[model samples]
Target: MRKIESSIDRRRITNRPIAIILAAAALGLFASTAVRADDSVGTVTQVNGSAQIERGGATIAAQQGTPLKLHDKVTTTDGSVTMGFGDGSSMALSSSTSVEIEDSTAVNGQNVPSRVTLISGDIHTIVPDKTGQPHSIEVNTENSKATGPSPNQ
Candidate 1:
């Protein structure tokens, strides 16, 4: 009976550290997810056909009103999606396109710094008129980079 009790006590001691480690890991994972959820920069205003949003190694269906965060990748298999940013700028992605939201922020209600990489296919953007402070929208492709409000403006 003494030996059996000693063995049981040892098992409890061994299991406690493992349980604590697991609990800590779970809490860390939840904290990171919460941070990502708080950093949304845009929303899927319209989605046609099939689309997905990839973030943090997970791919989720992209539907109208889906929030988009910086570093999020949006892919369209057979249709298109439109994303609208807080600064009133919007992007319309064509079918078979993959784009990553690189950086986006609105500062002082006057400037919106935004960029997207066009992995394939095409994207059309309508940037709202500049409000005094400089606004930039950079579209990058495999072979080219386009900056908007064209030089003619």
Candidate 2:
């Protein structure tokens, strides 16, 4: 009876550490999963390149390879600010316009939703047909949100 009890106690002790380790590992995985890249914002190909973008009374250049985020104010000095999307879609920010790359994501690893908020300016875009899934392109103005050209248009 004594030996059996000892074995049972040892098993319980060993299982506790295993369970703790597994829990820690799961938390680590969850943290990493949330730190993914914002591919929908795509790459900046023209920062301070030629067009001077001013935000908050500061002039910042929009260059290629810059990772844009939400609320990053952007404006064009001479030409339009261009941005590429993961689904081959793109947007051109008109001069003297303030645009923001709001919420964008490639959810479920299936389709990407590229959202842009034009606080006060104009945006021209080219939407793509991504496979069979419905791709979304939303543009928000001061008073309204507009969807891109219809799927058939």
Which candidate wins on lDDT? 1
Per-residue lDDT over 1-153 for candidate 2, one digit per residue giving the tens place of the 0 to 100 score: 455334356778879999999999998988877665333356565443255444456666777766555446676656666776556766767666677666666644623435566767666666756454334444435433445446675
User: What are the per-residue Cα lDDT tens digits for candidate 1 across 1-153?
Assistant: 354334357778989999999999999999988765577787999998999999999999999999898899999999999988777778888789899888866654432337777788777777666653334444435443455445556
Native-vs-model 1 lDDT?
0.78
lDDT (Cα) of model 2: 0.60
**lDDT of each candidate versus the true structure:** 0.78, 0.60
> Which parts of model 2 have CA positions greater than 4 angstroms off?
1-40, 46-59, 107-113, 131-153
lDDT score for residue 96 of model 1:
91
Give the Å shift of residue 85 in candidate 2.
1.3
Candidate with best TM-score: 1
Weakest ten-residue segment in model 2 by summed lDDT: 136-145
